[model samples]
Target: MPCTQKVTDDIVWVGGSDRRLALFENVFPLPDGISYNAYVILDEKTALMDTADAAIAERFLTNVEGALAGRKLDYLVVNHMEPDHCAMIGEIVRRYPEIKLVGNTKTFRFMEQFFDFPLQDRCITVKEGDTLTLGRHLLHFVMAPMVHWPEVMMSYDSTDKILFSADAFGTFGAFHGPIFADQINFQVRYVDEARRYYTNIVGKYGPQVQAVLKKATGLDIAILCPLHGPIWRKDLGWILDKYDKWSRYEPEEKGVVIAYGSMYGNTEAAAEELANLLAQKGVTALRLYDVSKTDSSYLISDLFRFSNFVLAAPTYNNGVYLPMNALLHDIAALNLQNRQYSLISNGSWAPISGKKMDEALNKLKGMQQVGETVQFRSSLKAEQLPQLKALAQAICDSLK
Candidate 1:
């Protein structure tokens, strides 16, 4: 039996979810699994938007067949060349030999590199602003190069006012029931996973995302059908505004995030003291995490959400802690900017993690330090309470 849902009068969602996979891309942990989306449009000439992962190949093909309902498939549009969405391309071609594969020039090149299937003049190459007509519907191709992939593109349906975004507005978690964002409590259920997905996977290409967003402003888009997560039919402005802010590397809230890498609980204790002080000074929007315990993806997501952050770690072998070092590298590699940060370092003999951390953060574009570096020898001394209080005050002032 195929599990398919109606997207519109002429469009049907043939995507499925994979909840058994522990990690996404073999790197980021997927606590609730992930979803892969593909759509089938039943027009005069039936067309498939994309393909799903090989993990769910049987179910995906069944859904596509059910949606087609004995109609011959005419086209298979390839918006992204990533394997997660393109893994079943060869299978799709084999199943529907008469189907024409639609994509850009680079998309064909990547397809040739990935699969050994014979094309035999079954390719329909399109360029930016190219339009493909299917009876009453028209698809306008918009080039979105380097929006996480060099061959990524988007298709805008002039008839239905729908944008088939490749992975631009994708999220992580798999859907349990509803497929529309308005049908569920999206903010409380999936916002964190959405932020984590963008910040970790596609966060490095902010400028490219900005370019795509600018191109999108010209089209009157009513529905957003991404490669993952729920489709957007209502409150589209909320998600669009979030992408704008995130692409510009701007914070969403005036709050602080405290991340600590503690070996023997000293650095953790210091981080808690600072959090306490910040809360006492009316800084309520705060998040505290253990870098050694929590994944770097979540930390990066929170840092992107908040305006201020505090990093506290213990010196190890004359360098910053191992977990904290990795976190700092990710922050820099992601091109995060315009953030305010504070530092705390602890060492029994030589406390130099603060200096190392400063050097790491200084390499970024618009990172600003809010308070003096607080150094402690293995523990927070009685006299160091004043230093923590002063740092809290400084952070509070900067927030105002």
Candidate 2:
């Protein structure tokens, strides 16, 4: 249903929509659904970009058939080897018997591993900057290694000047009713999805992304056609700008994000006290978010905006609290740098959380520790004002 969206004169979006959420892998616990996007470029010779995941293979083929009418598919380019994007390759090859599967060596290697080398007979290996002609359309394949996967490359249509990025600009959530960047409030969804995608999938490959960006520097790109989400025909620089900022591991602003999850009122009070103290010290963008109530997106947004972080959690069986641990597991994927932080922990008897946090924070590069962390046995009482003030003062000093 979403394939009917217009991208350019010759390019059409033939992607698949996700009807049910928590269906990404049919295993992971996902509240929001995912979309598998594929495109068909009807040039003088028809070229259908990557096929959608197996779940939507039939619909994806339908859309392609609709676009081609009776025209034969000349090329089926495989950018990523991920099952979600590559599962329908065998079927596509079966339907379009004469279509050539274009990809780099790594792509074909993965193709062999997946479909048992049966489809390998129709494969075409391409290197970086390799050009393939489909009728009058000239497609240049740029090798994009480790943007998220090893066997990934992007195809550029010279005639239409459209960059068919494999998964570089993909995000979560489905686009069923509305398509295109201008059709919906992209900010509401894309911002969070981008952070999640980058942190989880693409954050580790910053240098490779930079390489792709550098390779694309001289090209005259009018539209960026990614494998997922609504097509970008307007404000193309917006997503690229976001990639630049995120890839640099840059935080949004100079502030502190005090996120905590507490079982009782003890941790909450400490967080509140620290928040007030930071506010009193003229920290403009200070925010205290409860991880139990807030979604991962808001947490990521706060983490993105602030340079300094402070966390409070109670120890559970020598480990951190569930919500706090969950947040840490999520943040570990970010791999952020130049971050200044402090900690507060509660154990009642055994105080392992403070040291655990210390080790965890130390593993993070460029994470500057301000001062001694404040460990509370039960709660902050009347006598710990000096300690609390010192903690606040240390955080304030780190901000400078």
Candidate 3:
């Protein structure tokens, strides 16, 4: 164990892992160490928002004890049921047997499925437009269905004006000591990760997000507390503005994201040639993401901007490359519509990547495929030169 350290006054960040150790699923490595953020709100009654993983479970208890001092633990709220957030529930329940568990119907279902915890009949089940009062702090629970998980709901405080957003508005980095966003330069370090988290996890729930936003409009928000990364206290409006844009699937600009997976240089070569062709066709705003090397964050951030997406890859073992497949799965989950896409693929014997890629994308709505599937084999052959040129022209035509 690396040992735990306290980071903030009310927010005690309790984790001691280096950048390489990713404690949370899909979390980017932060140099300061990954903090499994579990907040202790000492109001008329003490309330804890989301517990840490099993490893940091002990430290989480310590933080709660420090916060409670003479008071007893009153409640433990699970915002997202993903194991990283809910893994320590059983232990916490054992320690604080009388502590009330807070969540909705979906939360209990997942709680049973994940650890077989007996919380359904015992805990407080809240629905949309419900409020729980803790002395001066009034906790309002809103139904945020499918913000990554079906059981997920977020709690907000009218007195504190804090939105316990679960995974929403989270950034990827070392869990900094200060819990507030004003203490860190998230625009430089965290915004990209937050975008990635949205695209990869919550993008499919755009409709639910609309509902969440509608409910949120009625309340005033000052601080946004997520299960991961720093809190948003400074420039709160900036984050809300970004979330509003992201949840609506609005692209930032008219650009193209050329993402592909290449076994050898041949598939990658075709991608490069396609990029040049797109440039020649006057699509100057081009961003190339090699799915094999680039992190999911950059890929997601690009997707939020470019209206057009292109995937190029070589058929591997009679299928698309795994990285490209994962990327496509994440993109499709976003339920994005009205985006034009092109495909370029290569296979030595049977070029199956293109066909599979097309099938994966065809599942998305309002997606227009450009021309025919451009094919190449082994290496970029002299015979295949014309095909790349044709593919370029097809992409240009789609942009028009």
Candidate 4:
């Protein structure tokens, strides 16, 4: 059976969720699974917003056919050329032989590189502010280059006031029954995953996201139809505000995130102590994680959410701990910015992880060290309590 939902009188949600996938992009963990969203806009000339991943191709194709109800798919919009969204392009083209593919110039270029299908006259190349009409619906294309991808763009329906966002306001989670944001407890259920998705997958392209947000202000959007997760028909401003803050590289709240990598338990103990001390000092929003146990994507998400953080790691082969080293690399690579951080390094003989961690973090924009690097030999002793306490106080003070 074709499982789908109605977005409006003429628009139908023809997407499905995949819960068995272990990881998203074969990197980020998807414990709660993920959803791939596509919409079918039925008008005088029908159009598909985008396509689902190959993982759910059977179900997706069925849903599309069901929504079309024997009608022809006139236009297939390619908002983001990423494989997850573009995987069904070839299959869709096969199904709808006369369908015209809609995208920007770069979109067609990437398409040629990815598929061997003959485009011929199937391409409808558009640019920023381009409009495509399907009866009463007027779709205005907004070019969002590097808003995570070079060929990315968002389509706005002028008549329905719906914005077909590519990946801009997406999250990581599978929908059970409800597909609308207001239908679920979004803040409690999906906010963390949403942050993780944005910070890790799209964090590096803050400026480009900002550009898209600015362009979106011109449109009168009443519904947000992203390519993943839940659809937004209510509380539009709340999600938009989140995007505004995240794209500007601003912390969502005043807090501390302490991530530590330890071979044994020495570094973990120190991180816990710092977290405890900070919490006792009136810092309510505090999180501590073992880099070895928790995924770096989770750590990166919190790092973006909180204003302050502490990195603790023991030296390994004269370098920062392996997990912590990789986390730092991801953080730096993502261009995480405008935050304060502290460091704790440990080693049996030579404790240089602090210095190494400090150097790696300093390369990022607007990263300020909140306290002096706390270095300990072997394990933290009574004598080191004062230093840890001072570092904790520094982090707490910065939170204020």
Candidate 5:
């Protein structure tokens, strides 16, 4: 039996979720797995929006065929050329030989490069304002270069006012029956995973995201159909607002994320002490992470969520700890900015991690070093309590 959901009277969700995959793109940790979304628009001439990952190709193909109900697939629109979504292009063409594959020039270029399929006469190259008509439904292609990928494009359905976003409004985590955002507690359950997905995967292309958002503002979009996660049919503004803030590199909440890396628990002790001090000072929503234990993907999500950060790590061989250094490198590489950060460095003999960490953070844009660096030898001694308290106070003040 095919597992699918109806997005509207005519639009059917022909996507599937993969809960067994440990990592997405062999990088980010997927604790709750991920969903690959694709849609089928039923009209006088049927069209499939995109294809799912190869991991779930069997179920995805069944869902697509089931949704079509024996109606031949007229067009297959290529949105993003990522393998996760585009892995089934060859399979789809093999199944539907007469189907017209619609995409931009770059999309075809990447398609041929990724696969050995001959796409000479099968390709329908479109441009920025290109429109494809399928009786009552008309899809207008909006070019979204580097909104993550160069060949990325979004199709707007003029008939139903639905925006077939490739991966712009996507999130992590597999779907559990309910296909619409309004059906579940999206904020409580999926928001963090969503933030993790965006900040880690698409965070670097903030400017390109902003450009697409600007282009979308001119059109009236009633539904948001992304390549992952649930469809946004009810509260479109909620997700749109998140995308706007995230693309601008703005923090969602005014709070602190304390990430520490410890060798023998000394640096961890200092991190805990500062967190307790902040809590006693009435600081709510404080997030603490062990950089050595927690994956950098999760840390990056919190770093993007909170406005303030307190990084505590001990020096090793006259340099910053390996895990902490990796986290900072990822933060900078992802182009994260417009946030305040404090540092706590521990060294048994010579303290250089503080200065080294500061130098690494300095390479980023709009990152401010708050308060004096709290340096302690071996462990956080009683003499440094005042310094820790002062750093905590600085973080709290920045929150306000």
Candidate 6:
């Protein structure tokens, strides 16, 4: 049985979710799984927007076929050339031999590299501001290069005021039943996953995202049809605001995210003590993560979310702990900036992890150190409690 949902009177969602996949892009962990979203427009000349992952290829094809209902697929829009969305492009061309593939020059360039299929005469090349009419609907092409991918582009439907965003407003969660953002508690359930998805996958392309957001400001968008996760038909500003802030490297909330690396729970104890002190000082939105246990993707997400950060780690062979070092390098690699951070380092022999951590953070842009670096000799002794309390007070003052 084919499962599908209607987005509008003439547009139907022909996407499917893959809950079995453990990781996305073979790097980011997907505990809630992920969704591969595609859409079909029923007009005089039918059009299909993107395709699903190969893991769900069979089920996705069934949904597309069911949605088409024997009608010919005249147009297949290639929004992003990423394999998750473009894996079945060859299969699509094989099924709809006469369907005109719509994409930009870069899109076709990547297509040839990814697939062996001959696309010489099958592709209809489009550029920025190019419009394609399919009966009552008109799609305006918008170039969004480097918005996570070089071949990424967006199609705007003037008829229904819908923006076929390639991957801008996407999240990392499988769709259970509802296919729209308004149908579920998006903020409570999907925001973290969405943040993780953006910060890890598309966070490095902040300037490109800002360029696309600037382009979108002139157009009137009522529905956001992304290549993954749920569709946006209501409270569009909620997600747009987040994108605006994230792309500009601005924190969404004034809070703290304490991430620590502990070999035998000493560093974690210090982190917990600071967290408790902050809580007692009325700091409510504190997030603490064990860097050894928690995935770096989630930490990166919180790093983008909160304005303040605290890193706790121990020295290993005169260097920063392995997991904490990895996290710090990940932060610098992502070009994270404009945030305040504090450090706590523990070592039985050499207490240089705090300085090492500070050096790692110094490589990033706009990273400000809060108070003094708290150093502990393997454990938080009574003497260091005052120093930890003072550091927590400094973090709280910065938040205020």
Task: Report lDDT per candidate.
Answer: 0.94, 0.79, 0.75, 0.93, 0.93, 0.94
Model 5 C-alpha lDDT versus the unseen true structure: 0.93
Error of 1 at 216 (Å): 0.6
Better of 1 and 3 by TM-score: 1
**Model 4: residue 166 alpha-carbon error in angstroms:** 0.4
Name the TM-score of candidate 1: 0.99
Which candidate do you rate higher for TM-score, 2 or 6? 6
Clashes of each: 0, 1, 1, 0, 0, 0
Candidate 4 positional error at 35, Å = 0.6
Cα TM-score of candidate 5? 0.99
Across 1-400, the per-residue lDDT of candidate 3 in tens digits comes to: 2233333344344432224555346454333445456677776777778887666666666766666676777888778888878888888788777899888888888888888656644689889878888887788888787777788899988887888888777765655455667777878777776776676667777778878878778889877777777777779778877778777877756778999888767778878888998788788989887899987656876787677888888887789888998888777766776678888887889988989999988888778887677877777887877877887787777666
Off by over 4 Å in 6: none
Each candidate's TM vs. the true structure? 0.99, 0.90, 0.82, 0.98, 0.99, 0.98
Deviation of model 2 at 158, angstroms: 2.5
Q: Residue 8 of candidate 4: its Cα lDDT?
A: 99
Please write out the lDDT profile of model 5 over residues 1-400, one tens digit for every residue: 8999999999999999999999999999988899999999999999999998999999999999999999899999999999999999999999999999999999999998999988878989999999999999999999999989999999999889999999988899998889888897898889999899999999999999999999999989999999999889888899999999999999998999999999999999999999999999999989999998999999999888889998999998789999999998999889999999999999999988999999999889899999999999999889889999999888888888
RMSD, one per candidate, in order: 0.8, 2.7, 4.0, 1.0, 0.9, 1.2
Alpha-carbon deviation at 76 in model 3, angstroms: 2.3
Q: Model 3 clash pairs? A: 30-174
Residue 102's C-alpha lDDT in candidate 3?
A: 89
Q: Model 6 over residues 1-400: C-alpha lDDT tens digits?
A: 7899999999999999888999899999999899999999999999999998999999999999999999999999999999999999999999999999999999999999999988878989999999999999999999999988888999999999999999999999999899999999899999999999999999988899999999999999999999988899999999999999998889999999999999998889999999999999999999999998999999999999999999999999899999999998889878799999999989998989999989988887889999899998989999889999999989988997
lDDT of 3 at 64: 63
